[model samples]
Target: MKPAPFEYAAPKTIAEALDILGQNDLDEVKLMAGGQSLMPLLNMRLARPSLVLDLNHVEGLDGIREESSGLRVGAMTTKRVLEDSDLVRSQYPLLWESTVAIGHAPIRNRGTVGGSMVQADPASEYPAAALAFDMEFVVMSSAGERVIQAEDFFVTYLTTSIEPGEILTEIRIPRLPPGTGWGFQELARRHGDFAIVGALATVRVESGLCCDPRIVLFGAADRAIRVPAGEACLEGAPPSEASLTVMGDAVFDAVEDPLSDVHASAEYRRDLARVLSKRAMSEAMSRAS
Candidate 1:
């Protein structure tokens, strides 16, 4: 299979890209930063774009900058670059961990952060990372720019709130609060395969009690879902086996009717969600404490 015939353009500036998007926005104007995901889709004939917009020469769309609020990551930042950056490894270890969990080395070498989120695979780690970290996505378009919360960004599987002619510019992640813990866990068919079940947990621990508990899961449903009910079940409780079991049950109870495929059965995936979530939460709370 091959994608339908398409035109290509490389725009150096945001304005130039916007001009292209404006003209071809409704004409399957595909944005191409890296060929990691789009190439495959194109070859499989799953996505047939009339125009491919290359964003390489688009400056200011790559790099890691820090500010009083937290980390501001350019959309075009590569997974390998983020993985190698000392600032990310030292300060945002969970994000670093998630980076490694993305595809294999070759894919990571060229895949961009923005592409991953824009692709919006339900099992993809970026969406979970953004939701787990409560990040905000800044999108730019001819109409102007607006910030969309991560929760709202992921509208459904392979879909996002980004409108046509809009490009994701950057992601904003708040600095980890003091005494905060974080963890990322996923159960994939293989290490690099799309996960059948995954979990990301973050919480603030104070005086030996959990506060601000947050647990978000991926790969078990159509989109990533925050399991506050599961988190609430862990409130004020130590990470004991009994407490974990209860929280795990809550997650399992909340995550039912998961999509079944060759990788796993719906029931099995839901069960894995419960188990992985508990382990992730335990590790995250341990680090927070």
Candidate 2:
């Protein structure tokens, strides 16, 4: 089925976009970036907004540049560019690896980073990467702009803290400290399908002991969730096989109610979480040393 008849607006500037959003209630308006996900919803008649704001023509929202904080990625920047960026590959290899797991080349060519984050899909890879890195989102509205930490941005399944009249403008990822090692792992039916379960890990080693370890899991909860218990298990501990197993178990146990659908059962998801967590932690440990 085709989307319900709706008005479309292409704003050349962010200010104009914000103005449009300010004029309409969120229930009546929808923002369109790559349209990889939104278009499907529209075509399915699941979303029937009165106005659709096309952000493709919006200026100053599609570039990547270096900043004192780390990398400043415009919300409209395509996933393909992110996967191929030299800076991301060299400095943020974990993010690059995670991006590669998103859909396929065709989808990545048009899918925007902001779209995936805002969509808040439980099976998406970007949210897991964002959680591991403590990424910050820059949100803008007519009132002005505000920075939101990744943890706070994602409120629940397909929900976020972004209010009406607000749009996600940028993503800021801090540089990983020296001795930090990272890993990303996911299981999918096919190379480009959404992950049945995904895990991302980052570990810092000092004096042969693990420190500042982060373990994030997706497709196991309402949103990307950090396994603090798992991370705590690694703190000050040697990154050995036994420790990795324990950490994975902690993560697996932390999942409250694993979502079960036609793709997999909750029991299967829990097992995947355990195994993937171990693999990710082990890879991170190997790189840390």
In candidate 1, how many Å is residue 112 off? 0.6
Tens-digit lDDT track of model 2 for 1-289 = 9999999999999999988887777789999999999999999999999999999999999888888778999999999999889989988899899988999999999999999999999889998888888899999988899999998988888988888788999999888888888888999998899999999988988888998998889999889899899999999999888899888889888886889999999999999998998899888888985
Candidate 1 worst ten-residue window by lDDT: 21-30
Please give, for residues 1-289, the per-residue lDDT of candidate 1 as tens digits. 7777989899999999999988865757789977799999889988889898999789899988999888999999998999889989998998898899998999999999998989889898989999888899999998899999998999988999998889999999888787789888997777798888889998877777778888988898888889878989988887667878999999999986788988789999889999999889888878985
* CA-RMSD of model 1: 1.2
Model 1 — TM-score against the truth?
Answer: 0.97
Please, what is the whole-model Cα lDDT of each candidate in the order they appear? 0.88, 0.91
State which candidate has the highest lDDT: 2
Give the clashing residue pairs of candidate 1, or none: none
Please name the candidate that would achieve the greatest TM-score relative to the true structure: 2
Error of 2 at 86 (Å): 1.3
Ten-residue segment with the worst summed lDDT in candidate 2? Answer: 18-27
